[model samples]
Target: MASVARSLRKVFVGGLPWTVGTNELRQYFSEFGHVVNAFVIFDRNTGLSRGYGFVTFGNPAGFNSALNQQKHILEGNVLQIQPAN
Candidate 1:
């Protein structure tokens, strides 16, 4: 459903807390702008968070907004954000 995973409008967020779920992730990122998609990766077998996720924005403005922010904190933990590979 995506043109490409490496677009500037997409970001890879690592260091997500176990408590951060898909909906929560979407909500947090909504501050920047309309979030096209957001979800936290999870371990398939254990059903726990894999401590990483991806976010796709509706526009590059949202992506740049998020990227320009100095820090991102969620669930009391700082997150590592980078452009999607």
Candidate 2:
């Protein structure tokens, strides 16, 4: 239980372009804070982006900064951000 509670906070990002990848996702969110881990879900069969991703912040400040922000635009698309369930 303590391990789960200490897990890095993740933020869900939607509306990402299919062109976006892990590197781009990490780069974009780095502005908010240190990104512990960031990944864009990809279709194994097609090798294409699924248009969404997850970002884990190294600390709470980074997590909250990303979550509190009203808008996040990446790759010419307005990204939807929220806490991951």
Candidate 3:
């Protein structure tokens, strides 16, 4: 079997609502494309949101789509989305 090489499509999301969860993040981003994975960074000690997260897309197209958008509003808060290093 041949191995398929896929380009990683990950984006850094910031300014998330304090109450935002992984499921909500994935649901919101899913509008752009297939969401491979979604996670919200948390404060290990407090187990609370760090106001940031990551969203991975199944393909580069989805990543670009979300990136090109002006801004995303989640729960009345504007989200900061950028290409993840």
Candidate 4:
């Protein structure tokens, strides 16, 4: 099984308003880590957020900084930051 720290990089964001896009989410988390990649979950047909997403960082230490500082959020919604699996 993968550890929590690895998972933390791939956070599960929630409660994102309909207006927000994957780019916006990425920009938000980038402050914490060197955002390597970010993908906001979306419906296959509609391409909309299922109110969650994943943010991966280049370095694990950056991920830890984001976690410890509690710097995850988007438009006032506190993110559900956690491991990917």
Give each model's whole-structure lDDT: 0.91, 0.88, 0.89, 0.73
Please estimate how well model 1 matches the true structure, expressed as its whole-model Cα lDDT. Answer: 0.91
Q: Write the per-residue lDDT of candidate 4 for residues 1-85, one digit (tens) a residue.
A: 4545455566566677767788998888788879888877788998776887777888887677766775555687767666666
The segments of candidate 4 whose C-alpha lies over 4 angstroms from its true place after superposition are 1-8
Q: How well does model 4 score by local distance difference test?
A: 0.73
Candidate 3: where is the Cα deviation over 4 Å? 1-7
Deviating ranges (above 4 Å) for candidate 1: none
Candidate 3 residues 1-85, lDDT tens each?
Answer: 1113232488899999999999999999999999988999999999999999999898878888999999799999999998887
Find the candidate with the highest TM-score and give its number: 1
Predicted structure with the largest lDDT when compared to the true one: 1
| Candidate 3, number of clashes | 0
Q: For every model in order, what is the number of clashing pairs?
A: 0, 0, 0, 2
Q: Residue 69: error of model 4 in Å?
A: 2.7
Clashing pairs in 2: none
Off by over 4 Å in 2: 1-3, 6-8
How much is the lDDT of residue 8 in candidate 4? 55
Cα lDDT of model 2 by residue, 1-85, tens digit: 7445435478889999988999999999999999988999998999998999999888899999998888888878999988887
Candidate 3 vs candidate 4: the TM-score winner is: 3
Sort by lDDT, top down from the best: 1, 3, 2, 4
